[model samples]
Target: MTKSTQGFCFHTATSSHVEPLPNAKKAMAILRAAGMKKINFAGGEPFMNAEFLGQLVMYCKETLNLESVSVVTNGSKVTKRWLAKYGEYPDIMAISCDSFDETTNVKIGRGTGNHLKTVVELSQKCKEHGIMLKINTVVNRYNFHEDMNAAIEEIQPFRWKCFQVLIVPEENGSEHTLRDARRFLISDDEWRLFNEKHRHQECFVPEGNDVMASSYLLLDEYLRFLNKGWESRQKVF
Candidate 1:
């Protein structure tokens, strides 16, 4: 099989620990050298750095000549006007909506209730501005049964919906109890079952292998701006 594309995730340095800018840049350079295209920006919340994001998007379009640029975000901070402004610049958007229920959503999103509503509204707004909208749902033990159905039902009208099993990354100081990735993680068997039950529509396991050369450029730019050594950091896996 052909190798997967490389992509990078970006987050602000102000809060929420673990900086991956260095690694991301390195990956970007590798992808670019290999003549790769397409880039995706994901984060703790990308909208947190509005100015940086705008510059990054522009750089991807101009410097890398990338055909596809996407951002995955939690629709807590963005508005319809802000989306309208950037909608033309970026090619696609994937908004995270874990649960349709407000109470469960608050628990999963940590005080961000009404995220489903916000994301739905944002999706509609994106459609108006000629942007493709995708919904991302993290299925886990807590909301697996009902949440999956809810997500499929609500997001079917949209262009795409990505259902992913929960992956508790090795950051945020919960490593001790979260040692077993399989314990809290969903199995491939579970995914198969979910797929069979939701056969009426097409759902996909995101191919995180896609690499974009611009990601490396973004990483290099971010590191040069900060002037720090992040070469020895631990991997999230």
Candidate 2:
């Protein structure tokens, strides 16, 4: 199967309450020494730590000289000044947008409301700033049947990623982390039907469980290399 990862993906933390790692600049030096060509900074919301996030992005682009430095954000705290100050470094700015409707987003725990509005504005800012904008959509029972063709066409992101909602064995099986997601699970046939509609879109990119499960290299908040998502084991520091 194909993978979404080409280089490094740094997951700062899972929630806003979790403290960020110390010595970010030093970590970048280590990654640069390891010859990382691409880097992605993710978090409960990386923008929550705006100052550090901006500096780290610059470090990757200017000092490490990585081929690409990008961030995966929820598009809530994005602002023109934030983009202007740190936009020049990253090659792609990705946003996680699941539903186009306001209520649907709240129901799915993606956001409170007005998510699509924020995304739309951010899309324009990305274009204005010359940053390649990408949207990552996690398909689930909530949004499986909704037709997003019109909205997608309007935004015209450089790349549109559609992922089949993932339920890891360690997560959705026992009930420790996030097994409740099982309520929103969909079958292969259901996913294919959804994909068939947008398959014609030139920018559409699709990923099934196989790709999302363990294909990418993920670094945890402590800068430890985790095996993969939810079911991750064997943390290599």
Each candidate structure's count of clashing pairs: 6, 1
Model 1 residue 139 lDDT score: 54
What lDDT tens digits, residue by residue, belong to model 2 across residues 34-99? 767888887657787787788889988998899988888878888778887988888898998888
Give the worst 10-residue stretch by lDDT in candidate 1: 1-10
* Model 2 quality (TM-score): 0.85
If scored against the real structure, what TM-score would every candidate get?
Answer: 0.66, 0.85
Displacement of the residue 5 alpha carbon in candidate 1, Å = 28
TM-score, predicted candidate 1 vs. hidden true structure: 0.66
Clashes of 1: 6
Question: What are the runs in model 2 whose C-alpha is more than 4 Å off?
Answer: 1-22, 227-237
RMSD of each: 8.2, 5.4
